[model samples]
Target chain A: MTSRLTVVYGVRASASEIKARAQAIAVEQSVEMPLSAIHDGSILSDIVGQVRAIDDRGNGAFDVTIDLAAATIGSDAGQLINMLFGNTSLHDDVVLSSAILPSEMLSAFGGPSHGLSGLRERVGAKGRAMTCSALKPQGLGAEDLGKLAFELTMGGLDFIKDDHGLADQSYSPFVDRVRVCAAAVRKASERTGHPTRYAPSLSGSYTDMERQLGLAREEGLDVALIAPMLAGPSNFSALRRNHPDFAFLAHPTMTGARVSPVLFAQLFRLFGADASIFPNYGGRFGYSLLTCKAIAAGLLGSFGGLAASVPAPAGGMSLDRTPELLDCYGEDVMLLIGGGLLSAPRERLAAEAGRFVRAVADHCYPRLSTP
Target chain B: MTSRLTVVYGVRASASEIKARAQAIAVEQSVEMPLSAIHDGSILSDIVGQVRAIDDRGNGAFDVTIDLAAATIGSDAGQLINMLFGNTSLHDDVVLSSAILPSEMLSAFGGPSHGLSGLRERVGAKGRAMTCSALKPQGLGAEDLGKLAFELTMGGLDFIKDDHGLADQSYSPFVDRVRVCAAAVRKASERTGHPTRYAPSLSGSYTDMERQLGLAREEGLDVALIAPMLAGPSNFSALRRNHPDFAFLAHPTMTGARVSPVLFAQLFRLFGADASIFPNYGGRFGYSLLTCKAIAAGLLGSFGGLAASVPAPAGGMSLDRTPELLDCYGEDVMLLIGGGLLSAPRERLAAEAGRFVRAVADHCYPRLSTP
Candidate 1:
């Protein structure tokens, strides 16, 4: 029997038309043609997707579960996504909600080489949630961005990442930016006695990213921020495999509207993201509190003996809400406040950063409370 | 002065909130921080996204145009997408409608190494719409698929492509499938006295794809199919740059719901798709006739001295509708009939495919049609 993985999709259709829709999705996602056209008995029995279950959610929505052959994927990450949601994504009425991967598929993916615990060890955070910020407002020169990185490091933040916008632009070439920021973080760490990590955003082709990674490694940087959606899931997987020592923070860019956030977090972690960053509830974006909790749970939940990934909630997050965010997310999280910390006066930026770090540290978790 | 590109987004908001929402999108996409925090003179003057126009489309909908600095893109296809819709994609209320790319930005991308004319020359097709079909129902072995390819070639189709689902699966590995299919097409072409290009689907990491291309070249196959969205835009661009002799058929998978299909066609062509395949109107997907026309126009229209890409309309297309489709798309298109021919009995499959070819060949395009 072929190894199978289960995938669930939230489909919008009337009750009467749901069975055909679910079956159509199963065929559309797998054989992609009439089942009678398939001549091979093994192919018919094993390869064609089987609709496992369909539960109506009312208001023109239903949850559909499908079982697909693992042989069709063959340890290829890109093909896995292609099999999971490639052609089906074309149907506007369907949303890929979740999946239950077989053990072999999970083993093939090899989630998080350096996950939450590894990240904590790198930053030396014992029992408190991590504090993080971003270097933003694109077109800044390397020296200027380095100065900002220095202040954030001085304020004892665990991670200072490059804004996803920062790439190999002429104004602040990737090499120059990494060199200066690495040195600045190292210099500040020597004084503050905190091992704050600086994660530069990666861009360009897979080869370009490899070259960038070489430069980052030369600068003694281990953590790197990458948008898996922008880089392609296969490239991200390849990078992770090639650089086992490097911890990755997956940026939720170009992906938010494509798939469910919970599924994305799970996939990112499985693809080797030590931390997955996303827009928090009541932020600039539209993810609700319930969705945020699910994303966090998906990342931190147990799955196929893989390490847990740190969920970094961000996007227009403020220092004032740090306690509430921590209370909701618990301790295995990274509170990323970007514009909120940057909004402080230039002279008082480090103080504001310190306050963010302190806010997370001072927050007490409510006993037996569900986020 | 910084070179700028204009990106238009369709926003879902009230008339009263359109201005603020548009401005917020500008700031969020460019800086990802509050404008007050950016004190750099050049950054404020040049790097910040400027709202150029906003037109109300009624019923809480508006078209908003924002000009972003071209320098931020930095000659990187992935970063170009990141700058265009990365963070904004997180906002459910927004949809990327189109972009007016700067010439330099256009030059950097360098659309389609071997576009429509080049592809037409390869198959010796002239003065008529090209005929194409996909080898589908993915679980067949290499030899079985090869036999199908031979039959399709015997039918005198212009192009035969691998189904997007036919990846490097264990059931039919890419190398074996490509080798067999290539040989089969060659054999059938010798007998039929017509050139039928075989386009194997490309998948896996960049390095893996490069190796696959090498294998394809060895088998004397000049055309290959790829999903730019699945491969990552930068990797696709790099592949085009690295292999100037090859023709690419861009598959619209994992991309349909994210951006406007018209914009997707333009972007795919810009990233080097000789033929951009999309769901035709009245097909399995939900694209309307107007949207399909716009997609075709975007692919065929003059843009920055780039070669025109053939818009291949596919998905649940049939032989009977060939004349109607020909009238809708004209001679500058590739009419793809997949399952329509495959549904025929094994004995009549070639005859059905021949009928499909004849349908396109016999149909006369309407005079001065818009599509």
Candidate 2:
């Protein structure tokens, strides 16, 4: 029997039109031609996507579940995405809701090399949620950004990452920036007596990223930030396979256009992201509270025995909302506060970061009190 | 003086809200923080994105233009995209309408190594529009797919490309498929006395694609198809630079969700696609006729003295509507008919393909008729 993966798409169509629409999607995704044109019976039966079920969710919305041949994926990460949403993404009415991949496929992908527990161990966080902050203002020099990183690290945050906007610009080349930030974080970690990790954003071509990773490794860095959508999914997966020791913090840049945040969290984890960052509810972006919860669940939930990835709720996150965020996401999360902390005076920056970190540490889970 | 690129965004906001919204976007995309946080005067003046102009297009729509520092992009293709649409793509109301890049940036990108004229030269088609078709229903084995390639080549088509869905599936491994199909196209080309180029769809990691390209080179294939989005923009740009002699036909799969099709055409050309394929107006996808024309123009128009790429209007294109397509796209386009020809019986496939080729060849330009 041919191995298959189930893909679910939320489609907008009336009850009278849904069946044909679902069938058309199956044919369009798989065969790319009419069924009558196919001569081979095996090709028709096995290769073509089979519509497993359709749930009418009322209000012109229907859930379409399709079983696609797993053989079609063939250990290629980009191809897997292409097969799932390549053509269908063109249709505005359809949203790729979820997928159920076979264990073999998950094994091939090797979900996460260093997942939630590994991340927790890296930061030396015993029980409470981890605290993370970003080094921002893209045009800043390497030394200046390093100073900011040092402040954030000194404040006792577990992770201080480069803003996704920071690339190999003349103002702050990747090499110079990585060296300074890593060293600064190390010095601060020694002073604070806490394990603080620096994650420099990885950009450019595969080769450029490889060289950057090498430089980062030289600085004793074990964590890195990457916008998987910008780097390309295949490149991200390949980088993960090549560097098993490094923990990847997946950024949500350029991702909102195609896949749902919930599905993206799962895919990022499968592609070896230790933590997946998303725009939290009541943030700069428009992701709803329900969608944010779903995204967190998708990252932390069990699937094919893969290690759980930590959900990093971010985008306009503030120090004041730490309890609420912790209440929403619980202990297995990374609360990323960027501009919220950086808005403080230069001398008070570390104190602001410390306050943010302490809040996460002190917050008691509402779930514990509910029972 | 810092070099800057002008980016245009279409925002959904009322007249009263447009100015603040535009100002917020400028700061959000650049400093990513409130102006009050930054003490540096230079950063405030130069680094932060400047709101160049905002036009209230009426009905809760406004076209906002902002100038961003070009230094933020470095020399990376992926970084360029990230800078342009990364975080902003998360906003559903904002569409990245277009961008005006500095000449230096365009020069760095080096649009289309083997472009429109080069593609026409390769296929031995002069003056008239080219005819192209895709090998479909992707499950067929290498030998069987090669047979279809032979039939299509025998029909006098200028280009025969593998369907975007066809990857390194076990049924037709990349090496086996490329070898058989290349040989079949060569055989048919010799018999028909017309050079028909075969473009094998490239899918995989950057390394995998590189290996596939090498294999294709060994098979004497001069042109290849790649979905730049799937390969990653940086990888695609690097591939073009690495293989300057090979012509790349870009496939628009998984593109519709983010950037406009018109902008994508220009970006693809700048990233070195010899031909850019998009879904036609009356096709399986929902691109409007006006959008299709704009896409064609974006590909063919002169930009920073870069070579023009051929616009390929595809997706459910048929032989019967060949005249209308030609009239709309003119001679600078590739009329790609895929499943429409494949829907014919097995024996009549070549004859149907021949009819498609003939329809393009025999059509009279409405512009010429007016003269």
Candidate 3:
């Protein structure tokens, strides 16, 4: 009656060798001893991960599926992650292409509180994809960054977040920056009567984090940004569990190197990110279009009956690429453009944002009038 | 007066092309825009990262140092990490070799609270190098694990942590395991008059984590294990900050791919681990000897005036390699033996632990009596 996790391992060995390796994995990943060492009455007998099926995927590469006992990982994200690929990550041949955790285990780590639809509802946008951008070049004082946020939000972007680089540095201390930027976004909403969600980067000590989160709430900010890779998945999950009102936008920064894009996106959604941000393909990052599509699919599709999270495609996005991106990801995606907007002349910044919004509008609502 | 980060990037282009790529990195990782677009009063004008030096290392590799305004990252570890190699990590050719954060920034992250001397004092050993082992083979009931802990402690190991596989599974829940393991170590210490610290894996909800730490303390445990890659560096740092008494042992899991062994070890130490644990070369994992040596050096070396953290190398460690492990790591090492000890016949388990401990002691205190 135990639930299992099916993991597809890319192993390099002969058919016979694969069997040996699978047997080794069964021990290595769990008991770390031969079957004889495990006692008769030990619970280890029941909970040991088993290599169920091995399918060859050409040239010494076999898609080894290991069924790990759900009880082994239990409810801990950290332990589950360790079981998934901790020791195996160091091995070159064992690439973890996919992992399907049992529902009982997945539910323990609560998924997004406010998912794609909830986020779209918060943005109050209809018939068009959401546009997200960053206020960047981190050395700015809180006042200056706040001003930029005001301009961008007023210019028609649905979501305005701090750049992944924005942290609690002296130039813009987190408390000060979040306070000012939150205020600025509110002011923009007041003027344009169009609310734009501000997601400040979450970083610093737990006490400091609590204060920052509280401050964002006090300032009426709806969304918060956290680079889950840097902060850890558990921390993010804890935040999502505690704060039901704030939508989380998970940033993929300083972490794309280790995690496969699709897996990262899937975990991001599973860990309660309303918007899972990633470096889009055909952009500055070398992610393939297929990987981006896969990531998008993972975020939007249902797994473990969790709510669908938004797929935020970022990095080198320009107004010109909006239609192609729309064609690629369809309607339920967030187009995050940073450098491209900063490339515009300051006098034309608002106009540039407006153009990007119009560009998205045209693609999504082709027959309808631009609103 | 701004501090800079020195990064060596592995490029796939000519010398001039490397220079250009370095230039691109400066803007891409910081402003994410061309300098021409930045205006007089913009933050990009003042705080944009500068490519200070680019040394051609031949073979399309170059050591490029980018002098970024310290204010760009601020003091948050998450932000500093993001700024250091976030966007660049997505680049296939870009490999980060070393990073020197400003002293102010480094101190803010807070390196190991309980370092080499502190750990040595905690285990009640003045001169001899410490011994550490694991209580693993995950399926064991709390009773067996507790008994095993008692034997290993009596056999003369300083530290005993859980196998990365050991989690809050149904067979052995975390709370129950910690209680049994802690009591066993305490009983062993009572008889042997030697302290053997038990560090259960910290890998669940913050509440569950808090309870585990509390229970460990309640039962007189001194050390706790955390895999920072899975739990997040910030969580580990916060734990170190909050619990000054407990020694933190970091497990390198699910993270070796993104970070170089040396840099990863350095960062682990920087984030407040009393000991940095990683897979050694010639073990089950594929880390090279040179890389393992570098990791050991990183843990032991003085960086930002932080105390030295012990280098605990494990994964397929055995009694035979103890002398070589000691030779490679010198005295400031914790050789983690897992299955090696587990494979020993039930009657000879304690004796096997004693031999391994003697091997380490022989290298460190060659002439000293077995006191």
> Is 2 or 3 the stronger prediction by TM-score?
2
Model 1 bad stretches (over 4 Å): A368-371, B368-371
TM per candidate: 0.97, 0.97, 0.93
Q: Each candidate's iRMS in angstroms? A: 1.3, 1.5, 2.5
lDDT tens string, model 2, A1-371?
Answer: 78998999999999999999999889888888888888899988889999999999999999999999888787888889888988888887898888889889998898889999999999889889999999988889999999999999889999999999998989899999999999999999999999999999998878878988999999999999998888889999999999988999999887755467788889999999999999988987889999999999999998888889999998887899998888888999999999999999999999999998889888888764554
> Pairs clashing in candidate 2?
none
So what's the TM-score on candidate 3?
0.93
lDDT score, candidate 2:
0.90
Give candidate 2 regions above 4 Å deviation. A366-371, B368-371
**Model 2 Cα shift for residue A188 (angstroms):** 1.7
lDDT of 3 by residue, B1-371 (tens): 44656555555668657777888888776767657766745455457877877877778777777876666766555556666677787676776667776787678777888889888888876666788888877777798888888888878888999887787777788889998988888988888787778889887655556678898898888788887777666667777778888888988876646557688778888888889888888987778999899899989987989989999888877789888777777788888887778778777887888887777676753344776
For residue A186, model 1's alpha carbon misses the true position, in angstroms, by 1.2
Residues A1-371 of candidate 1 have per-residue lDDT tens digits of: 77898999999999999999999999988988878777778888999999999998889999999999888888778888888999888787898899889998888899998899999999999788999999987988999999999999999999999999999999999999999999999999999999999999999999999999999999999999999988889999999999998999999898847578899889999888999998899998889999999999999988888899999999888899987988899899999999999988778988899988888888887777678
DockQ for all models, in order? 0.73, 0.72, 0.59
- Give Cα-based local distance difference scores for all models: 0.91, 0.90, 0.79
